[model samples]
Target: MNKIKNIHILILLIFLISIGQMSQTIYVPSIFNIAKELKVNMEEVQKLMSGYLLCYGISQLIYGPISDKVGRKPVILVGMMIFILSTFLILFANSLELMIILFSIQGLGTGVGGVMARTLPRDIFLNYENLKKANGFLNMGILVSPLIAPLIGGIISNLFEWRMCFVFLLIIGILISTTIFIFLPETCTKKQIKNSIFGYKILIYKKKFNYYLLILTSGLSGIVVFESNSGVLLSEMGFSNIEVSILFILPIPSIFFGSWYIGFSKKSFNYLMWKSVILCLLSGFFMWLPGWFKIMKIWTILIPASLFFFSAGMLFPLATTGAMIPCKGSAGTAGALLGGIQNIGSSFIAFISTFLPKNGQFSIGMITFIIGVIIFLCWWKLSRLEKI
Candidate 1:
C-alpha cells in the first residue's frame, strides 16, 4: 500500500475504534433510562456499565499478544465483528440480565479495538516525534468519543427510544469491520510473530516496567472510580437524563485543553508525569476535605473531579508512552501490558467505589484521597529511581 493510503487507513482505524468506545459512553445517562424502562434497579443497570468495563479492561491482555502474534488488522477485524454481533444482541434485550450479557460481549470485542488502537500507532511511527504525534491523535480520537456520545444518546433516546443507540452501534461496528477487511494492511513483521505469547510472558517479568505500570495503575484507578460511579451519583442528586448529559460534558473541556497543551509541549515525560501526579493528589485531597464540613455540592464535585481528569489528561499519555518506551523488542506486548495493568487498576478502583458508603459525600471523598496518595507515592518512587 502507498504511504498516503496507509495513513488514511490508520486514521480511519483510530476513528472507528474510537467510535466503538463512544458507543459505550453514549449511554451513561441511558443507564438510568434503561433501568427505569426495564423495571430494574438503577444500580443494577449501572453494573451493566461496570461489567462492560471489566471485560473491556481485562480482554486487552488477551487481544494484545494475539495481535502481536497474528497481525493488527486481523485482530481489529475480529474485534469489530464481535462488537457488531454483540450490539445486535443488545438491540433485542428485553431483560436486564440479557443486557448485561450483551454489554459484556460488547466490551470484550471493543477491548481488542482499544488495544490495537494504541499498538497500531507504535507500529506506524518509530521516531519519537512522530510517535508522540500518533499518541496525541490516538488520545484525541478516544477523548472525542465521550464528548459527543452522551449528546447523541440524549437526542436519540428522547426522540426515538434507547434501543436505537444499540441499533446505531451495531451498524457502525459492521461497517468499520468491513472497511478494515478491505483497507488495512498488516504491520507486525514475521520475526515479531514467532511465539508472541512467550514474548508477552518475558515482557511481564521486567522489573523496571513495573514502576511505569504502577504510575498508570494509580492514576487510572482514580479515573475509573469516577467513570463507573459518577452517573449514579448525578442521577441520585436528581439530575434528569438530559441534565446529566449536559453535566457530563463539563469535565471533557478541561481534559481536552490540558492534554492538547501538554501533549504538544517539548517537556520530558518524566517531568510532566510527576507534575500531573501531584496535581491529581492535590485534587483528591481538596475533594475529600470539602465534604468533611458538609460543604460538598454539585460544583464542588464537578470542579475537583474535572481537575483530577485534567491532570489525568496530562499524565495518562505520558505514563502509557513511558511504559512502552523501555520495551526493547516486543513493543506490542509492552503496549498490551501497560494497557492491561492500567485496566486492572481501574477495575479495582471501580469495585471499591461501588461499595463505598453512599450515605454521604465522605466515602467518595475518602476514596479519591486514598487514590491520590497512592499516585503520589508511586510518582515519587519513579522519580527517585530515574534520578529525575
Candidate 2:
C-alpha cells in the first residue's frame, strides 16, 4: 500500500480498536439514569459493564483462530455485523437482564474487529521499534474514544433518554463495518488455522511469552476495575451525568502524550515497561492514601487515577507487542489470546468490584497497590528469564 492509503487503513484500524471501549464507555454516563428508569440498583446497572467485558474477553479467543482460518477482513466484518445487530437490538430490551444480555453480545461483536486492529501493525511492521511506534499511534487513536464518547453520551443522555445512546453506537457500528468491508486487507493470510483449541494453546501456553501475557491481563484488569467503579462513585459524590462524563475525559491527554512520546522516542517496549514500573508504584501510593485516609475529594481519585492511566499509556502497547513477539506465524491467535487474557482479568475484577463495599474508594486504592506490584514483578521476571 502507498503511504496515503496506509494512513487511511491505519485510521480505520484505530476505529476498529476503539469500538469495544466506545461500546462500553459511551453508555456509562447514563448508567444512573438507566437504573432509575428500571427501578434497579446502580450496582445492578454496573453489571452491564462487567457483562460486556466478560464477553469481549472470551470472544477474542474465538476470533483469532477463525481469522487465521478465513481472513482478518472477513472475521472483522462478521464481528462488526454481530455488533451492529446486537447494538441495534438493544433498543428493544425491556428489562435490565435483557439489556445486559444484548450488551454482552455487542461486546462479542467487537472482539474480531478489536483483535484484528492489534494484529495490523504486527503484520505490516517488521522491526520491533517500528511495531511499538505503530502501536503507540494505535493507542493514541484509542484515547480519542475516551475523550469523545463521554462528551457525546453526556449531552445525548441529558437532552433525551439513556437508550438514545445506543442509537449513536448503532450508527458507529454500521459505519465501521462498512469501512472495513471496503478497505481492510487480510493480514493473517499465510497462517493456516488449526483447531480453535490448538490456536489458543499455542499462543497462550507458550513459556517464553506467558510473562508478558500475565502483565497485560493484570494491568488491564486494574484499569477496568477503577473505571467500572468511577461512574457510580462520581454520582455518589454528587456529580451529574455531564459532570461525570467530563471527568472521565481528563486522563486521555496524559495517555496520548505518553503514547506519542514512546513513538517519537522509538524506545523499546522493555525499556518503556521498566521505566513505567516506578510510575505505577507512585500512582498506587497516591491512589491508596486518599481512600485509606477517607479523603473524599475528587482530586484524590482523579489525580492518582490520571497518573495510573498515563502509566497505562506506557504499559499497554509495550506488553501487547511483547506478547506477540514469539508468535510470528500466528498473529491472529496470539492477538486473540492477549486480548482475551486482558479482558478475562479485567472483567472478573470489575464484576468482583461491584460486590465490594459501596464505599469502593478504599477498594480501588487496594487495587492500585496490588496491580502495580504484580505488573512490576512480572516485568522483572520476564526480563530475568528472557534476557531481552
State which candidate has the highest lDDT. 2
TM-score versus the correct structure, for each prediction: 0.92, 0.95
Residue-level lDDT tens digits of model 1 in 1-388:
3568657856876766676567667787787778888998776676676677678878888888777777777877777778888888888789988888888888888887667766776676665655655566566566557556777787778888888977777777777777778877787777654336577667667665777788777776776666667777787888887887778778887778666867588877677777888888888987788779877578878898888878877776666665665553566677777776676667667766777765456767788888888878877777776642
Query: Candidate 1, clashing residue pairs?
Result: none
Over 4 Å off in model 1, which ranges? 1-10, 191-195
TM-score of 2: 0.95
C-alpha RMSD of each candidate structure in angstroms: 2.3, 1.8
Native RMSD of candidate 1 (Å): 2.3
Error of 2 at 120 (Å): 1.9
What are the lDDT figures for the candidates, one per model?
0.73, 0.79
Error of 1 at 349 (Å): 2.2
